[model samples]
Target: MVFLIQKSQNKDSKAIHLKLSEIIASHQGTSNRMVNIEDLTELELDQLRKFYVQLSKLAAKEDA
Candidate 1:
């Protein structure tokens, strides 16, 4: 039972990754670097998260 559950979860994760990759490829101005971003080390992902947070704040200030 444990093995079956793990298999299903893995399949779901792969499907989600593929869907996201397709979206990134189709969207204009979306960075190709974002494709396969799941492979990034945890620290690298954290840095990207922080960068986006700062960018969001800057955009908010511009809108004010």
Candidate 2:
């Protein structure tokens, strides 16, 4: 149903937002390269997917 689809998308967005926050937190004082959203290319994005998976696994483990 449309509601389910909307809920799924919302969940995904929240996951992405949480993962992004963690990623930023992890690099808070490091010299790690940070890019602006407008500067991201497709390849940079593909690489960033790894962080999301890692963050989600971490979150799942914490919940369990």
Can you give the lDDT of residue 7 in candidate 1? Answer: 65
Query: How many residue pairs of model 2 clash at the backbone?
Result: 0
Residues 2-36, candidate 2: write the lDDT tens digits. 99888667656554554565565575453234434
Q: Write the per-residue lDDT of candidate 1 for residues 1-64, one digit (tens) a residue.
A: 9998886676556545544544544547555666666666556655765665576687689999
Q: In candidate 1, how many Å is residue 45 off?
A: 0.3
lDDT of 2: 0.58
Q: What is residue 6's positional error in candidate 2, in angstroms? A: 0.1
**Candidate 2 vs. true structure, TM-score:** 0.42
TM-score of each: 0.57, 0.42
C-alpha lDDT of residue 25 in model 1: 40
